[model samples]
Target: MPSSAAWLMALLLNLMLAISTVFIGSCLSESPSKVRLVGGAHRCEGRVEVERNGQWGTVCDDGWDLNDVAVVCRELSCGAAIKARSGSSYKPPAPQEQKVLIRDFNCRGMEDTLSQCEQDGHVYNCPHTKDAGAQCEKSPSKVQLVGGAHRCEGRVEVERNGQWGTVCDDGWDLNDVAVVCRELSCGAAIKARSGTSYKPPAPEEQKVLIRDFNCKGMEDTLSQCEQDGHVYNCQHTEDAGAQCENPDIDSPFIPENVRLVDGPGRCQGRVEVLHQLEWSSVCKAGWNLQASKVACRQLGCGRALLTHACCNKTTQGKGPIWASQMSCAGQEANLRDCPFRSLEKNCTHDEDAWVECEDPFELKLVGGDNPCSGRLEVLHQGTWGSVCDDGWGEKEDQVVCKQLGCGKPLVPSSKARKSYGPGAGRVWLDDVVCSGEEQSLESCRHRFWGYHDCTHKEDVAVICSESIPRL
Candidate 1:
């Protein structure tokens, strides 16, 4: 008979064998079995195909459904399965392409990959025309305002799987409205209404596809909001609706379609403008600091520090040159409002315009005896520059003092210049005006940045009543 130690050794060996079996089985299950979606609008939604024996072939739709598709969507890391389509819904496979090589998927809908699902057999039971297709929520969806007085007001309908459907108003509110307004380039959300408040064009016909949307009012699209996927409990009568104020022609909100791409950050990049749903570059001809200023302000950036011409750098762009011969006087509210010539084919992308804007303005008191008293220097375009005293007064001084948390302005109008002395560098402002109630110096009316006519002798300075921490 074997000793007790030998019995224990056998038990340990069995335990080691069990763990090794599981590790090997898991690794084998995850081995490469390539699957792809083909012949659809985008990568995420298409006819299903799988690779077998070094050849690619379609999947038979004999038993395809949302449950089977859920495995495929999970394998691709797509959010969730929106729909499972077969036959005529997707494009037919080419004549010379391989026939269906996979069929009869019995997925529990939580498998890591389609290959892990139980299949009837490795056999072809259908023709290429009967291939399966899937649409996932990860695909880009389009949103539009319908049945309203104008483009910016009405019933909110979203497009998914190439079909238009209404959103359920179960939890819709101003937060959702804000996202819709920003997406449509409308200024801001005026009101959020329900289907009961604003009757859509046709109620019973529209399908309710989305429900319980949770939005933070910052997303660029409605589909980005967290929501239940394809809720069937909602009726068109419960559709979401909104009223948005159209941005004024000169408002920066109207030109929110402009963006900076392929740069270090949002404020510096090759400039692009959305025209007819396509992004096009602006030609460098006649592009200058004035045009750059409007682009910067419209993008919620600070003053323009350098244009492509000013920096002598080039970033070639693709597609159409939308505008040329820009002639801005540096005060236009939006880039579109500036006078510019139409497209010129002769211009190439190498002449595409770019801009480096000053980061959001940073204020500091320099050359003073203490933290709260000094020449008023502003950090712009990566440099500390002086503000002009051409229109300096207690009103302007009060704003500067409050912004720095320096208690209050100490210099009375009678003794405005207490000899903090003039500052050197670019004169960033001139002819300033303030109403004493503004929060910051930038909010006050002033000449365009870097357009001052005064010299350093007129540089502005101030003395505050309290000393604050150093910046």
Candidate 2:
């Protein structure tokens, strides 16, 4: 028989061998097979899955945020993360040994790989139905799609600081409207509505976001378009909204067309409707701000700048008198979408209706003790709101100074430390991309006129030379 001491030594050797085998197995399993995006429309987006034990599985959406999504995007070199999707919208691989390999992820949005993220190993509370999804993009968008009747038509809203807010309709136009439609893979914008009218109650915390969006009509998302960058200059009434027409649906509703003609800008012109293949003028009988708003937004001109009582101006081109009056809730995308009298009532050339949408963005300064320095604000019709400090620098500041006749700027600051304080109203404009060669600040490239992601605390302030009085 073996000695007791020999038996103890033999037991220790077997234990050591067992530990070594397990460690080596773990090491082998960790590498080669990696995290990947699956079940998405594109390779860069889809349900998040990890391979383990030769089986692919999903991750729980619990505590899943942009950080976790970012790590996966970086690992695959698929650009930046556009969204962190929730629910099992993307179906996972079936009947796997492990349906929930990665229980949960706690990444800091800086991890190089998904394995580096903290996970809730041996998850018992999570289920496969809670699987998470992600969308990585070559050009990530700050915009999101939510609460639409179908996923394409709904009140226009934006995300800021992790909170969702409605967009102001002050300067929303066709190009701006089109971007939101295309972002959701929807058809062109058939209607641009205002958040203030016939709309559901927004979250108490819901802010009135981006107002004036200037897209070339081809920008991928609203964030890619030019904006004003301040919130204090707009209201919920100006909250931008849109309803997209699904391209997949053939023969969409094409309403009678109305065009603004003979005005200085695209926004300001006499109203004309298409009838019998020949455009005719709309009568000014019942023309109101509500009706004019629809025309301005539908025409891609923005909100109604001014409704000319030009019942006296003659039509410029070859359009005859058409409708008597048009009634709109100020939310319709098309003027013809509204209730109108198509009966060709008594309307002469002198009774032509004209509407001028906002043009040459109106800007101002507020919250400053002196006119030279303070919070920035812009005028979109009646409401007055402030501008954001994003992308605000020397070049843009110089233009503001020149516009206000403040002379040279002493210190152009993104934060309004020296100013009175944050102003009241919606924060508009963000990521203003200025070329530095533009004469005016408004002329400098910017995001939608009223869209912003910052608070009034981040309002821009400029200290001018005070414009010394020369005797």
Q: If scored against the real structure, what TM-score would every candidate get?
A: 0.29, 0.36
RMSD of candidate 2 to true structure, Å: 19.8
In angstroms, the error of model 2 at 341 is 7.1
- Overall lDDT per candidate, in order of appearance: 0.71, 0.65
| Regions of candidate 1 where Cα sits further than 4 Å from its true position | 1-296, 299-359, 413-416, 469-471
Total clashes for model 1: 0
lDDT score of residue 437 within candidate 1: 76
Residues 228-329 of candidate 1: C-alpha lDDT, one tens digit per residue: 866977777778898887542332212325777777777888888765446777666757788888889876588899887322334567677665465666
Model 2 stretches with alpha carbons more than 4 Å out: 1-183, 188-269, 272-290, 296-337, 340-349, 356-363, 367-369, 378-385, 394-428, 432-451, 455-457, 463-471
255-274: candidate 2 lDDT, tens digit per residue = 34567778765567887766
Worst 10 residues of 2 by lDDT: 247-256
